[model samples]
Target chain A: MIERPHHVPERLGLLSGAAADPFLTEDLLRGVQGHGGVDLAKVVEPLPEDDARWAVEPLRDLVDDAMFQFKENRTDADGWLAPRLHATLRLTRREAADKRIWNHIALAVAPDYVAWRHLPTASEGKVPRINPVRFMGAPDRQCFSRLWWAAEMFRNGADYTPVVRACSNQDLIHNSLRVSLVDHRPTAQALVRILERGTATTGREINGLITAINTAGATVIYDAFAEDEPRDPWALRQWITDAESAPPVPRHVLPTGPDEEPVREDSVAKLTEYFADLFETAPVRGRTP
Target chain B: MKFYPYKRLNRPIALRVMSATLKLPDGTFDPLDTSAYSVPQRTVALGVAQHEDWISARIGLSATLPPGATDADAPWSGLRVLAVLTDGDTNLRTTVELRQDAPDSKEWSGQIEVLRDDHAGRASLAAYAVATVDGVEGRSITETDADWTVDVVSEEPLGGLRLDVKQAGFSKSAREWLRPYADVPWVIDTSGRLPLVMINTDVEGFSDLLGGNGGGIENKIHELLLSQMATDVWTAVFHSAVGDLEVEPDGSPVFPTDWRGEVLREMLPDVAPGLHVEEALRRVHRRRTDDTGWVELQTRIHYAAVRRAGASKAVANALRALQQMNREDSE
Candidate 1:
């Protein structure tokens, strides 16, 4: 019998030496081990691993695509990753609200990615640290959760185009997501229209417009003017039910969300015009008459 | 009480006692409703007088003559008349002083003056009295023909008026209270050791914490990186920080010292190669214009508190550190 040495090798062989080092690889493996395994079956509940409803492999594929597609420009990763992440991880709002599932994924499955993505700068003058909340927290603060929500909120009906636009402007997303008014589909789409129109170019402009809109909301009734379609509860239920047979989200093209009606065009148009006027009158920093 | 008697020789003297009744144009007893008098029976009694002949005698017992009631006094015009009456118990007291002047005309339209005293000797008189002759009502001076119309328009002595009260929320009070602090730019003090220590301490743990999936580290890192980049780009494009920068006296560098740009410059070399300062500046400019796409992806996580065993000192230190870093970068 060959005797195993007491001391193990300093590094573990995984990917190419250039691509994978022991520390990162070990950390990644440990992260997966910490939660059990990377199998979607292990992380998700009420959805078995082998069940058709379980799309863990497909989700893993999506993450891999994101890693490859955005290899050069990581900042550009969000636009590509958000909608895809949402598509791959098909979940109901109730399921998503549970922080445990997200915690399992972050801590147990893909901690290495979290570390890789979140490493602190040297100027920070401390060991790189992560907030435990990211592992399991509210959707707004969760690592993967915020992106999914952003995509979900900004997407216009089945179209993900507006999501892309809205995600592009970090200020808009950061500010808009915090505002309850953006839940109104027309308001979200109208904001995106403003961004697309180049009416709000700067962060301050976006912030100012958001502030003005929020302030104006105190007086004017936005819903009275910009009406939206009533949501069909059955559509979401149908979509979630269809998750068992749903195919992987297309990589090259933007995936379609539930077949809900898009925001009213007339409503969006009216808001676009109204918001434009507001932006004109808004007090943007350093903007002189 | 003096009673003047013109005797009809060997016959009973017939002296008719005249009394006057006055009514406001609205046909109401104005003084009875408004007067501070303890007894209001006098104005009602005068208001119900029957005829002109009864004016001089019945009114003489209770009511004071109006400004124009006697020719020796000035004519009363555009003044409300209130009938004054003596106490019922003192009906026999006839010699009384009229505090105000009597009206010059018999058809007098003026206020009647009355005097009164409590049993405690606290004597006071009505400021003015109203009197009108029965069967001789005067024409109303006002176009609106209001009842008991008094032309005595007096300005209130007090200058200010009380307005309606309003209620506000906690945030409103906070904003109002903090407005002064925000008015002038808040100059971050960088020389403080607390902020530096706190920032360094947090930054040390930041990397490890930021790593892993679904742990918000990635999002946080992304936000920090973008914020750092944005600070640099804004500085490059605008030649200043978006917010105010605090500087030391005599043009010396404060703690913040535009550290954001320095940090970005250090990281840019590692991220992209062969980039000159001019190119780097240009890149920042281009990113500023094109980077609107990343805004939505940025998530804000508020750090409620980072205290040590229920002590806020640690968190306070952390804030100081953040402020110091910001100040140094801006400088």
Candidate 2:
């Protein structure tokens, strides 16, 4: 048996300078080997090997592609990577809610990715460090979990296009996901539509619109107007069941969601109109003049 | 040397009445029932009775005399003499003076002396006097100058329900309600169930439309409210039960009679109802079934369409041309 020596690259700053000396690439590979052959299957719990969704290689490849694609613009990676990651993962909402699985992925399966994606930048003469919460926190706060949940909540049925738009606007995904109301499909869709239409181009505009909508909701009943189709529970069950035999989600094109009915166009139109009306009255700081 | 709660000098006059009776030769001269004598100017009146040279009279006194004054003036002295008048009328007038030595002390005493009286009676007479008191003058007292202090406890409870505006999702509503008294201290408990929905509209211009101040806090609250409203609407549409739909094994409702197809068929009357079923089935064919080997063949066809779309020739070229034309016209 041969023991591999830990190797440190020449550039210390390439990886976060805050990491300890032993926390290098060779050490990470050793950790992966120690945890059973760098297969994410060994790391995640409850999911059996036979489950087609259990394959981690495809996801690792996708992550690599994302890291390569957004090499220059790390912030822009969230919008592009989130929906694709969700589509490729192909898990039921029930499975996605499991924090243990995300914890394992961030800690054991892909700690390097977490480090790469979320290592904080230095400011105010102080060295920046990653918060531990990003690896194992609530769904709305954890690094990968937040992105995955954002993708799930924002995507239209059988359409990941709207999700891309929503995620692209950092404020919309980051702020709206924390709010319980974004759980509504039509509202999520309508919000994305507002962005797509260029009704809200700037971050300030997005913030103002969000504020006005929240305030107006005190008196208005948004549900009374924007009706959505009842989700067929069997469809979701079937979608989850199909995971064992389902093909890999396409890398180049957006993956299809479950065949459940999309939000009604009329309802989305109504909300968009209502929200537009609200934004008109909302007080924007610079626009006060 | 006796001290009362109220000084005798400050106390109003106390009036006392005394009477004596005179006896007449006839047994009918009982002064107890003497209604004959009347005095117009007398402040007090007395009645007398006489029986076999033994006589007595009853006297009544007025309450208008000076404090501590005694009945020793002209009217009272005249009443001591028994002068029978032919006119059969007797009356007396008198004045009483009250004196006090201590002007500043809480403990002070006074005496009253009655004066001036003219009375003429047959055998015995009774006399009475009235008393009066003057007002006391002093400076106003401050709280510090007072000897004793009184503290009153409020018999009422504290003000309104304390609410945690953040948790209750009523921060905005609570703020709005409390806006008029912005400077006043208020206790808000935000633990109560909020009736309002918290929406998060992360879109531009929406918050302004809703009349929110587009500050970060206000915008965040607005987005929360909108999100809640959207969820409510979505839940109502999707989760509500209908009589016609059959519940699937997994608890999803299914249209037992192809009801959805029927509606679509009816809307597009030109398309035969049977053809609508075929179209729906064709759309369904795009989905994969575990038992059906037909999925592979169907996927192949889909792949071919996708490949053609990707390739720079054939159907893809035609579609691209059409899309380009549409874009040009819109521009």
Candidate 3:
């Protein structure tokens, strides 16, 4: 694997798509050498010099540790990395929505991590190429972004245990995140619950279940049946405010997210039952009636 | 636009907001102006700064069902009314159940809590009546004909696609990029998060003419000039949006998620009439890349832009003002 950048920025900087495009060369994507940090840093539009939260060393250390720790099993890295990444990189949804920030993270700071994690397994008989979208793409397709959003969407209020569970299932992250229906907290929890209970084990099963839920979502308002507690914006704001002095997320223990109330148990149960029923009738190609 | 197996109310449900209040960060509440709601536009602006310390906004909604809704022999059972607040940007859907006014009352009322964190810009609110029909539970029997736009961030209650307009002295503005475009009265920039119409104040009296809400021929001419600008902006944004779209793994285009998506959704139907927005986008994208039918589609695209800018209406008003002025001079 490629080494960490020689000189990491003190703070995170925005890398516009145009600035980042040239660096996403074919050589870097094929697990080859990427441009060093010195060249990339010259083009980076620096974030506000004053904000402590934009500090890059903490984030660099996190990704470096993530890569080293998960060297044995890369696919497992996502479950470990997602919540920690979110906790470490404190941002409002508006700030997170900016593609440029994520683009910078993937290209300038951690292109090696991108290639290491997403380079396809040697099965297709094609050149093992990493998709450039992983470096600079939509939230769902971009490597770092998908993890951040998965953490955001699946995290039950301040609890990220559900996020870990959701990220564990690759199919859940791959298929479910693209669908807006999973944004509903109860609905997100219910999918995690189904996966935990072994209702849908295979990728195909999970994909079918997600499709069924999304289709049913078009007809029925799932929120009407399984209502979530109205989250306090103050709590989220306070949590973000606390990021400046917050401790680094633990390596072993799962970190707690914002101090907000978790999704109601009854709502999760309601949707779990409803979704399991939907999955049973859903057309899984390999499964027989 | 939606089909259900159950027997539904033929008449549309009438939904209106009865009150709106904002919850502050320090645990106090304040009344939000009722003018923040536009009945004609069917939109309610939750008049609180999203970045401010406000916690949430509670919008009290009243919905009146059609006459047959409360009939004793109605086909459905376990009837319930709900207000669904959906934010496409955040992908959060919140539903609040409404209570009937009396035993067989057609009037239903409830308040939906708008969490500031859950919405980015505009969220949509719609009312639906659901019930068990033919053994299917929680099936939507009827819904509001049009969803009301609940803009969590915007202070104005205007509906439809609204682009940002800013007054900048191009010659001496803080924005360095605008300095190059100083000669022009305005420029349309779609590269940003939203399409911004930068009206250059360097053009003498240009700002007054565009900003003027005065009476007489001046107002008519102002309206005409604004329409012309809008036409140019709409055209530019549409092209910029179509030019830059993400494609799925299967090579099909993925509908954008930002202002590009909104612009496409609003103008695609007009650009490619009778086709769904997604399909229209695909067609337009295919033509642009494949070197076929793109040049021909330019007229339709321009027409859509012109229509959105209300060029015809502006021209008619200008002509009417001229006619009135001619009559006054003769008199």
Candidate 4:
């Protein structure tokens, strides 16, 4: 695998699609060649120089550690990297929505990580290419973004433990992230609890359950039945503000998220029971009556 | 009315916004502009990006249930009214309980708190009357007929499909991308947070063609040009919306939650009449992916786009103009 960028910037920069496309070469995606930092640096639109949050070296170091530690099991990296990535790179949803920053990170800072993580297994004669979507696509598909958003979605306020459990199951994140139904805090927690209980272990079963939950959500407002508390916005703002002075997220221990209150216990219990009932009748492809 | 399997209040609940205030960064409350809300449209624009620092908003709500709601013979007991604030974008729902004005009175009032950080853009505020019925707790009996929109980031107090329109000289514009399309009269970009219609000022008289309010042929032509632009925009956004749908485990397409959902819900009926929006979406998805009947569906898509653009109305006006012109020429 290729090494990290030779010269990391002081702060992160935005890389537009027009600028990033040239470096996304077929050879680089196929894992044979890589883009050197020198040429790619010219096109990057740098973020504000004074913003401490935009610093790049910490992010580079984190990804490096992730690659080295999970060298044996690539999929295991997701569970480890998600919470840490979210905690280390603190951003508001508005800031995170900007694709340019994610593009810069993928193409300029960590093309090697993207290639190593997403490069497909080799066939007898077919070339194994990393999907471009992993580098620069929708939030649910992109390599780094999917993890960050997974943590944001599954994290019960200040808790990051649930995020780890959600990321452990790739099928859960891959299917659940696309649906709006999971945005409900109780709904998100209930799904995680279902996963932990080993009710819907397979990808097909998880997919079936998620589909049923979303379809049923169209008519039934989950929030009404499973009531979630009003989140304290001050807690979230304080969390984002504290990122400036906060220390590096500990490697061994899971990092904490925003200080807002977790989903109510009764609410999660209500949805858990409702979702379990739905799963019993959900049309899993191979499940027999 | 939407049907409920369980017993519910037959009459709709009367809900209204009493007042609204925004909390500033320095622990002070600023009364939001009275113009922030549109009663007819059921929308509240909590100012623009300037209010981003505003921590939270408090909206005073008043609701009156029907006469028999509080009677002894009422079907359900333990009745409670709640004001709910929900943002689909963030998936956050906050509910506040409302107390009765007097013992056994039908009137209820309360203040609902809206956290700014919990919402990214627009959140909806609605009132629901709930009570235990048939052994089910927190069962909704009635709700506001139309939920009010609370847009934290918009300057205009309006709701639904507010497509942005801007004018810039394509050749000399700050947007480098538009320079390449300098020759085109207008362009529609659906990739951003909201759909935008960029009118090229470099194309001389193009703005005049679109903006002018003249008599006879000039007016007719202006309307036609606008209709054409609207047609293109609706078509582009519709294609963009339907082209990228998330599928269920059983291979059925799921409706999007963003502006794409708005576009689909608005246009799907015209695209496939007499069918539910979900069914229409499925048909559209099947046609596109299976590569069968897609070519045939183009006419329906075009017709839908034209209907939304009001092209038929423009054509009617143009016909009337043509008839008048011929009569004058013959005279």
The lDDT leader among the candidates is 3
Error (Å) of candidate 2 at residue A258 is: 1.1
Ranking by lDDT: 3, 4, 2, 1
lDDT tens digits, residue span B97-184, model 2: 2122233222222222111011122112121211121221111010011011000111111111111122112233322332333332
In model 4, pairs of residues that clash are none
Clashing pairs in model 3?
none
Residue range with the least summed lDDT across 10 consecutive positions in model 1 chain A: A11-20
lDDT of 2 at B88: 10
Q: TM-score of model 1, chain A?
A: 0.79
Q: Write the per-residue lDDT of candidate 1 for residues A230-266, one digit (tens) a residue.
A: 4444566567677778888888999888777888899
lDDT for model 1, please. Answer: 0.43
Fraction of true interface contacts that also occur in model 2: 0.00
Q: Residue A253 of candidate 1: its Cα lDDT? A: 90
Model 3 lDDT tens row, B176-247: 556667899988866555577889999999888887788999999999998999999989989988887766
Error of 4 at B326 (Å): 10
Two-chain DockQ for model 4: 0.33
